[model samples]
Target: MTTSNWLLPEHLSDILPAEARRIEELRRAMLDLYRNCGFELVAPPLVEYTDSLFVGNSQDLKLQTNKLVDQLSGRTMGVRADMTSQVARIDAHLLNREGVARLCYCGSVLHARPSGLLADRELLQIGAEIYGYSGYEADLQIIQLALDSLALAGVQNTSLDLNHPGVSRALIEAAGLQEQAGEVLSLLKEKDVPGLRQLFEATTGVPDDIAAALIRLPSLYGDGNVLTEAASALPDLPGIRAALQALRTLVDALDATSVGIDLADVKGYDYHSGVSFAIFGRGWPDAIVRGGRYDNAGSSFGRARAATGFSLDLRKVSAGLAPAEPSRAVRAPWNSDPALGEKVRQLRQDGNVVVQFFPGTTQSIDEFVFDRELVSDNGQWVLKSTN
Candidate 1:
């Protein structure tokens, strides 16, 4: 049997009318919120040279990117897997502002494969980034904006999970485990204390203090108390101390009930140079928002600047919300009468959805509920409520 023409590739699908409308509404609301907060919107192209696209990104991002050859220039190009780097390039080269820049963007990003078994290969990614600011204050603003974005979408009970890659990187480097950095990072993410002990035991020349601290990193998760516990449990390395202090600042500033500490989170360790965060809603298995500081990402772009931001897949967030309500609309007749035509135009101009039905046919769409109709009464057009 031949394949159906309508069949889509695995993990790829189209958004139907109802879902598309909801996603679009969310896109506008999020962008509006960002604009209200002084972030100017910028849209990067969907395709770009691989050299520029992959600059300052992590290996995982490279693997997620889909590459193709440009027939015009014979150069390699890539469909963006993430827009953060592109936005960073804009801040470094295009805008090139001296003091600070606030940018926001919303667009589709293609991934070589689904991030999870049930995830789609295409994502409607929306986020805001702040460049040229090094202080944790920038981080705080980004995090708050992320939370507000969720709140605007009616998501409640969101808990923010915070991590700093420097804490683990410091221990690993101090122990001279650069060669085994990948393995160490993996173990830290899994929080496999026994596995960590086994690796450290087999390896020679590892500092006992470093090994102990790395092993302790995984359990240092919980509420604000985790930070206090870490200060005494881990070594007094400057990097480690700095990481804890950053966490403390956020904890003291944010609502304590909605924050949690996870020092062993290695999710963005390679990409994020400072405190990274993931916001999870109640009953959701994955993070709804992911962002942090990556000051070194713009280095390859020829200008290094302080950067921090957070992004969320709009489609994913929309998927978790309740079904969108059908828009109330007025059904109008397709007629030659000037009065009827004028009335329909006024209704539509007044923010009413007026759908004109064909003279001899009827059509239906789930996107709209025809609650009212324009009827001719005594040669005068008037709106009649159907509900």
Candidate 2:
């Protein structure tokens, strides 16, 4: 029996010509946008040592990473599951700038498993990062950039969900529940009020007020009023107060129409240390972009700079948009004439797509529309509308 040689593994696929072209166009446009915004471009290696790849990353990132042994050194190497950590490594160790460093990157990332049931294991991740800035100013800039990115991709009616882990983290630490931080965070993320109550009920040494605040987190999600309610509902721990204030500052600063606050939505990498965010398009189920402050992300790379950035799967963004219109092109006859060659070259130089077909070549390509054709009129090559 023979299996199909062209078949790809599950959750992996080849991007065909049309989709590939659209994704590439979007990539170039986004990179230009980043550049105009003062972000210097950087490209990190596709694979690195597991130690470096997994540095300060969450267990989710480690599990998602595809690992292998480097035969040259007989050491473990892994394909990056997320480029954020690699970008952090570059800022901390490679650039080593004392002042703020704005960097952007675009590349392929591999995951051992799909992020969702309909998701692919491979992604074209593109994003921008700002290093050496820790203020709400940095967070606001990152957030605006993310919103601008979505707009550039023609994604509209998007809403922003804001969350700060410090709020929940503060309660957990103040209550001496750091040992159960994982379980507590999991429950809160799911908004499992019952589970949280049960955990606090059985766990000893947690103050009643802290447990109550922990249980209330699942309910502390809504419009701007959530912040006011949180200020009154939750205990006034320094971490909680600071986190709420940070969220308040951003909510005030952002001009976006649909902004939300979800105190329990700490569903990102564990490295996210401050105000974190997820931007969602109107109809899409998942966030179109995710980013936030991770001041400690670079500590493992040698320098602990303040870092904030956002990343989105370019392929996913392309998939959600309408099919790209076929590019208009001029059909040219196959010829060895120097004049014809020069004419074709000049047209292409002027940014026109000119397709030259062989003597018996069939017109079958779907990526370009042959709207016009090059023809000989009185010994001069000229463009004639096919229509």
Candidate 3:
């Protein structure tokens, strides 16, 4: 690349001042929200050993991770494409808390490629996690917390799509189609009815009931009523029945937010073993929040804990939201007087943004539109309104 083109790389750009301010404001608000909910903030390293980082059912994360050799140790180090795995490691090995542990994290994760045509290769991920809880209560709490976070960020007209991977997994296992499960799962994720039918038809010795169940999976999407339809349509396998009951319980408990169910929805099929959810705003094309229950993610760290959590891209959440109220600025004249310095310090200490004017400046200090100015009045320094 020529020097003239030495700007930002493809799918990557700097967040300028205005956007940066908005992102920071949202970040602080989200962290405060998590803190109030009893979640402790944790900052994991930007990179870690590839072996440890790729633990659990995270083949997608492994593909997205950017790998490089750590010269200091000669071992492959990977820039984290997701922070959930790191948090799991911390909970299982580092903190190793006995009871339920609530933790939150906010940081940048790098992806080797963009998620979509217009997606960024880097993202500011913020989320909260609950470990040591396996029941539907934990899932409901995390979902409610996610809704709260979106509300705090000013997201409106939101809808949540909920699913249980076990529903489809159970169907596949019961069908004796474990060998072709990967292909079947991919088709389900795409909602490709024709493709699924073709695959099933071409495959020999598929049980008639199982094939019919697989075909119905893609169409089993709608509001809470779909759960009833699913229960009646799917086979009488224990896992399938249990998953449907879980979804029904969640739907019955929810009141304020709009919810839907997609029995074939398996975005994180391999990673999330239980209920999975994605939040969609009115105008956003992609999900703003993606989370679910990944109970076995911490197994590699020597302890497997039941965990449920959600994460959102802070930058994306703040994109169309209103910026926070700007702080009042007090412009003070550049002077060597110790009293003047003390006054400036006092103003700042009282929660005001004070910008000192520099001597020999060509531009007017007032050009910055400071809300107030410190000037001599009646032979004493006083704050004069610039408005």
Name model 1 segments beyond 4 Å from true.
Answer: none
The regions of model 2 sitting more than 4 angstroms off are none
Considering summed lDDT, which 10 consecutive residues are worst modelled in model 3?
Answer: 360-369
Q: Summing lDDT over every window of 10 consecutive residues in candidate 2, give the lowest-scoring window.
A: 264-273
Winning model by TM-score = 1
Q: Write the per-residue lDDT of candidate 1 for residues 121-208, one digit (tens) a residue.
A: 9999999999999998999999999999999988888989999998998899999998898899999989999999999999999989
For candidate 2, write residues 6-65 as lDDT tens digits: 989999999888899999999999999999999999999999999989977488998999
Model 3 segments more than 4 A misplaced: 322-328, 362-369
Clashing pairs in 1: none
* TM-score winner between candidates 1 and 3: 1
TM-scores of the candidates are 0.97, 0.96, 0.93
lDDT of 3 at 174: 78
lDDT of model 1, residue 15: 89
